[model samples]
Target chain A: MTLKANEIKVGDTYSEEVCRNLSRTQIVQYAGASGDYNPVHTDQLYTSEIAGYPSVFAHGMLSMGMTGKMLTNYVGHGRLTSFGVRFTSQVFPGATLTATATVTGLREEGGENFVDLDVSTTDEDGTEVVKGTASARIDA
Target chain B: MAVDRFPIEAGHVMMFARSIGDADEIYYNEDYARSTEIGNIPAPPTFVQAGAQFDPDYFLRPRIGQEWFGSAKGPTGITQRSGSGGGSGGGGGGGGLHAEQHYVYHKQLKVGDVLSATTKPGKSWEKQGRRGGKLMFSESVTEYRDQAGELVVTATSVGVRTERPATSS
Candidate 1:
């Protein structure tokens, strides 16, 4: 069942696969869709030769968006009161990313119930790529 | 301040979902979406900010020698790294990075809706970095409203910039 405000506990955690593995097509598609054509994201030569990175990386927004998917999938859409994130590390190609959402706090304000969560994304090796928090309104 | 208008289209929504590796048909397939609770293409939560690429004066545009966070420049006036110190190069302020990002969705934005956005700087501060020296941060908030004047979304994003370390003693 979907998580409702009343049923959620402070320590509840949710985890899901966000991306199996990043590919160049998806990265370029993101650049085309989001209008961020930064060479470091799209041009492998620029990343390896100019930027000195082994491989091109995905945009931080891409990871954040994937994490957002985990929240919407579990809590349901339009329930997000607020969401925030910090870019912790770079995500490279062939890296599988999983997003975890942990409820950190619950509070009542102005007769409304809110669930606070610590959200994060990590690669297969457990390197945190993104970390942040989110708040959602649930039925009391 | 003037409001910048951005339109939401089905094609754009589909491409965005695909870009993020989200295969949910609701974002792309109209027939599949018609049966869902939303009954139409549902734009992803962060979709609105994706429209910023179309804004001529997009806030994240890199500036030279300007104090910036979020992948641009900074206040130090030191542009590129001399490669001697533990410095990351982007020419003075060209290499800013995003420190934090926040989004508050007031309503579900659907395809065919046009959003009007107004953005302004929110907070600016500085703090000591553990190793990167002085860190600069700036925050900006963009409020998106639907055609009916209903506040649809409020997005707050923060960026961090670090001064390049000195090369020589």
Candidate 2:
């Protein structure tokens, strides 16, 4: 039930169109589930006044989650072996977030099929919130 | 969460790794981790959150006793290979939409390295979402300090939440 390496070639793109919008309750829940509760995430006044933000924002991990969705949707679950990323900018709430993955490398090593992906989450203004790479070992 | 009272210890690093489903050798085996560039087991960026350490009352007083849910909380690998929790479509965001996410690693986390983390709400607001749904993003900034109280890592996560659409399921 997993995607094989040969099944995913370079230049493959998955449909990552956002389906539904995220809400406040979900943010609170994520904080609870993830055990993160920085004021910058939940307080608009602090962000706009103290932190110098236009408003509150989404968690960088959430942006990464979107990238994970893109990779999993394309390569399937078990097939994805490693995923990592670096955060570049803040993602404000209500900003349209889009996830995309570009296969940078597809090779065989130690008798394994692997795909190297350059993933990213961008705002409607093309602000890259999270940039990352994901590699998957396709089923033989 | 009794985070500050947990009494951070070197032994707890391994225990934290086990709790988060990360079996990365570097996190569990000090010797193996020492062989890497980090010279020790590097804490997964998001795994740092597991420390549950908070700032002293005199340091960040306004942030004491904040309420936290266990829903959208995700780990951002802080200073090394980082990330955790998987699933597609934010079918479970508590109230905010996931606008963006990113992590910056200043160095590597090693075995026996004791660290502390404190959480605080960033900001909140209302915005119009596509199709008229209410949208918001909640940012949480956690500061990680080493045993010497030196700032080791600073992690900020944003939770973008919007009202679920009223369209057909």
Candidate 3:
């Protein structure tokens, strides 16, 4: 869907919170697909014994990807101009995540419309995992 | 650093989508994707984070003596900090933490695309932390291009290495 710049309202949010549940297998698949084999994400024993975490945890990129899915679904693919995130907390197995994107800025630059989004993801307890912002150009 | 060219396959795209709990059919089924505006399976937005996996000489590979900040066991061996820590928090012989990530898309990445990437350290700075002492920050930018030499995606990630306070042993 193409977002019309004129139709966007600053401070107006789009969509409800999207949620997902974390699993170990998914983490391992991500490790394989992403080529990030750091044991903290795949090996429970290594995480607990070597890394000192209670269990293998999700990669920060995994959570960031989830947020990307949310924003892309809202704005459409290949239309994104910029996306970014700051990793805030560790996500462990079995953690449930919720994410949302809000329209923070809308304007016309060089005759093209753009929308600024404030994106955030939190666990079930409302603790922030990833906090970020994305800005995209709206196709005419 | 240079990331060797690698083909973007449909299966890997699908796997990455599922791994993130995204069940979108366009990322997997070519037939379904063909019906979409993209006309084929295009990777999810952050899919390029896996760009390192495309290269054999990715600098962040974990080794015995290489450490920047947090746990060496994390993907890319970059650490994640929880805001409260002594020197013990980000140890691993000086490993850096993954501070931030930014991506700018010029073109969509689709299946069957052979892509190569080049990464270089960008800006570097330092700032004091409340409890973690002085933090040294650096940015790395990776540009991905298709075989035809078109820019597909440009991803920039920041890392922070901590220096313990004088009080810490």
Q: Which candidate is the best by lDDT?
A: 3
lDDT of 1 by residue, A86-134 (tens): 8888788787999999999988899988888999999988989899989
Off by over 4 Å in 1: A48-54, A107-113, B1-3, B31-35, B58-88, B91-95, B164-169
Q: Against the true two-chain complex, what DockQ does each candidate achieve?
A: 0.40, 0.06, 0.42
Lowest lDDT sum, 10 consecutive residues, model 3 chain B, at B85-94
Comparing 1 and 3 by DockQ, which wins?
3
Candidate 3, residues A1-140, lDDT tens digits: the string is: 67877677888786434445677888878888887766656766545544445666777888898888888888887678889999887788888888888999887889888889999988988888899999888865
CAPRI band for model 1: acceptable
Off by over 4 Å in 2: A18-20, B1-169
Q: Retained native contacts per candidate, as fractions?
A: 0.50, 0.03, 0.52
CA deviation > 4 Å runs, candidate 3: A15-19, B59-94, B163-169
- Alpha carbon lDDT at A122, candidate 2: 74
**For candidate 1 chain A, which ten residues in a row score worst on lDDT?**
A44-53
TM-score of chain A of each: 0.94, 0.83, 0.93
| lDDT for model 1 | 0.74
Q: Pick the candidate with the highest DockQ.
A: 3
Best-fitting candidate, scored by TM-score? 3
For candidate 2, the per-residue lDDT at A37 reads 59
